[model samples]
Target: MKIRISKATIVDERHPDNGKKRDILIENGKITKIAASIKTEVDKVIESEGLCVSIGWMDMRANFRDPGDEQKEDLESGLKAAANGGFTAVALMPSTNPPIDNKGAVEYLLNRAKSGKVQVVPIGTISKKRAGESLAEMYDMYRAGAKAFSDDKESISESGLLHRALLYTKNFDATVIHFPYDATLIPNGQINEGVQSTLLGLKGIPAIAEEMMVARDLTLLEYTNGRLHLGPVSSAMSIKRIASAKKDGLRITCETTAAHIAYSENELENFDTNFKVLPPLRSEQNRKELIKLLKSGKIDVISSDHSPEDEEHKKLEFDYANFGMASIESFFPVLYTAVGSSMDLAKLVATFSINPRRILDLEIPEIKEGVRANLTLFSISEKTVFEKMNLKTKGYNVAEIGKELNGKVLAIFS
Candidate 1:
């Protein structure tokens, strides 16, 4: 597909074209020209004054209910949503009916995703069947192209199981991702435990539930000396602990979602089910502290924890609704506006592009000559509204509907 993008500002901090507005010519899936005022004809021309280009974005965590629950989302639709969000790659959580706990499942995901523009990297579950019991075949899945191992949304309560899994992955340097939360602490939790929950009269999920789990995981990391990834550390206290752990040189890294940084518990005041998420949104101070962690480089990546729940499951009573928010396509725009007051464009691009691939140990692409075109064409000034009609996912659990924001995904070259 030959394409020419004229007057697109390059926002990638890794290359020399950081802030330059120049014409880029791509042919046969490779960048052919990136010089000033290039006279060329191509199959397509994407010219806009607000145009911006950067290294392709990647999301480290997203749940697509394929293979078992195709009514919610399949690989094809999920990847389409990902591409619409400007992500060239997305790491899928192993939360399917028959969870990806073996080599066959990993190979299945890779093969099934070959038709999509977005690359799907399956994250094998930490325990067999994601039961939080016996360890799964980590080495087997790793050899089968599993990028990371995680029991998505399931905390490993067994200290010995977590310890053993961590140590086992050391042989291949595979990361064991733990969703930090002590299930025992928030048994009947529905909303974040705070003033907002008090007014809404909903069961509260305490922040300490996540805090204690993070503390426990850090201790296990020290004891086993294993590669551990503490995903989506949401609270101020949790960030403090992770910062301290990093200072202690523990083999640990952490990230937070775009939603966490933007919205908070107050979003649930209307009893909107779409805003209901695990490790539910925290206080205003906590959200600011999360953004501060990004500014200080304590947080590693900013991902869209895009979990799509069907309308039937989402449009129920607050207590009975499934936990999720549909925001893959509107992710960049929503995030760009939400954090524009504080975050610079360069830093945001780095967090979205450069840091994620580093955390997953994947190849990072540079927007330069001689490299294949793995890029996201975007506009930071374009206005966007994330309504039901614009949603690309099969599900309809949109939390930010009617959200007016900046930054739109013009196109993606994968």
Candidate 2:
């Protein structure tokens, strides 16, 4: 159905100054006209008063476990969750059982996502099968529509191997997302390494485990003159490292998960498996530093990280429980709750909408005339509760579950 949105506040995010109330026209899946007081003739019209119109949100890192573990989470369910979150594009991580290492898997994901409303960009695996030993067929996968390459679940800390992958991806002018973690430094660590771990009687994942790899990765990136992306970087020190690297003009970008920004090791006192995650949550001080860094333009993007685990895996003891949360549905409201009023609506849209597209080198869809009708409508004043059972994904392990949240995604068009 063709529709026109009138009297809506527009916030493009990429350009904060352009945010103001305006009338927008949409027809045949493309934005036809946008002005302050445009006369629109359409079969349907939406009088968006308090709601804000902006470019569609993009989740730079999402693990939709299809083509292998659909029961955990599939492409269809993931897209539904994304649409519900006001996202129009998602970068699918390659952490499936076989991993997205070859051309066949890339094509399958592209075709599958083509049938959906949201755009899905396949992320190829940097290491074959995510083994961290041999490099995957980067050239072949890139040709098959892989926007970027990453080993989502684990990090390739091996210096020599990572160097090879970086140089290999350079041929295609694509970025290789690195999961920064030093295996030896972080052995069997459950939560963040701190007083919380000691009081809770749990193994600790040291901050150095993440910071060390990030230091090395930045150095290698400089030497190879290749693009490097730090995915879901959790540690405070890691953010500092990335900031320093960027200051030096290193071609590096970083993203932090919503969990990392909202909660901290303090959430682990209840022994909640949903609080556990890769590069586990850090102290409150670390959480504040991350938020500050995001405001300072150090962190380039924010993501869902969206790892899905079965009940058997998350319902067990804290140590044996899986480390992740299903965050797609709760991503926006939770983040808004965390950074409400501190950053204006324009900056908020920038983090979720335009920044992600820039990081992945995607063409940012504009709110002007003649662009695709790709947009998200939302109201920052609204609030809702996070009910796990009501979520679309099979994975119900989320720290924000059952919590009341602000900012609701009203609709998404793509």
Candidate 3:
């Protein structure tokens, strides 16, 4: 098959044509030519006003409840949602029924994802069955193509366990991803601990829960000299600490979700269950701080945190609802709308594509001649509403429904 992307601004900083409007031609999935004009015959033409093309975007974190919970989301449906969201690759969180803690489970996801357009990089659990009592076979899972190790939403509460995991993975230069939260500090917590929670009478999760754990993880990373990735960080204090650690030259990286950037604890005022999330959205002040830090390059990635739940689990009372929303299908549009003007286009491309690949030790694709085309095409000028009609995932727990977003994904070639 042949495809032509006409007059789109190339957003890859590694390429010579960076920021230049050019026509890109692809034949048999390889980039054949790129120039000022290409009027040759093609099977398809992709063009739009204010169009931007970059090496395929990647989400560093997402949950596709496959293997045991296909009722919520299987590999096939999850990859379709990822492709629609303008991501050619996504790192799968190991938060399934059994959890991906062994080589067999890792291989299962890889083999299943082989048939899809969006590539899946499986993350194995840091503990056996995500129990946090003992370590899983990290070396064996890594050998089976598990790019990283994490307990995914289940924070490694035991200091000794997390320390050992970090130390063990360093032998192969592997990254240990952790969700920073001290579970003990936020028992029965429902939302951010603030005025919103007080008015709604929901038990609030204090910011110290996240801040304390981030401090502990940074300390462990420094002691063990192992690479670490802290994600879905929500508090301003955590950001301050992480920035200090970065300046001290620790082998650390971090991420925040698009939902955290776009919404805050105020969204929970109406008792909407969809706004419920782990590291539950903090104050409006923290939200603004997250956006500011992202523009300054303090945050390394922006993931969807695309957890999916069936209606039975999501359509419950606020306190009973699961802590997630189906977000992979609307990831790009929501993020673009949130920070498109304040951030440089090149910086946006880096966060979604280049940085995540580097952190996970994956191959970073480029927009050059003779290279295979792994690309995402989008338009900042296009308007889109992320309602059920456009949702590709089986999970229907999205909060952005009926909201007009600023950007739209045009196509993905992978």
| lDDT of candidate 3 over 234-299, digit per residue (tens) | 987898898899899999999999988888898888898988999899999999999888888898
Ranking by lDDT: 3, 1, 2
Any idea what lDDT model 1 has? 0.86
- Candidate 2 lDDT by residue in tens digits, 180-281: 888788678888889899999998988888888888999899999898989789987888888898889988989899888998999888888888888789
Cα lDDT of candidate 2 equals 0.84
lDDT of candidate 1 over 1-414, digit per residue (tens): 778888888888767878888889999989988987778878988987588999899988898887788899888889989998999999999999899999999999999888778888889999999999999998999999999999988889999999999999999988999999887876878988999989988988888999988988999999999988887667889878988998999978887888898889988889989889877999988898888778888888788888898889999999999888776887898788778737667778787788878877899988887889999998877788777776679978877688678878888987
Q: What lDDT is reached at residue 241 by model 2?
A: 84
Clashing pairs in 3: none
Quote each prediction's TM-score: 0.97, 0.96, 0.98
Predicted model with the maximum TM-score = 3
Candidate 1 C-alpha error for residue 253, in Å:
1.0
**Candidate that scores best on lDDT:** 3
Better by lDDT, candidate 2 or 1: 1
Please state the error at residue 203 of candidate 3 in Å: 0.4
Stretches off by above 4 angstroms in model 3 are none
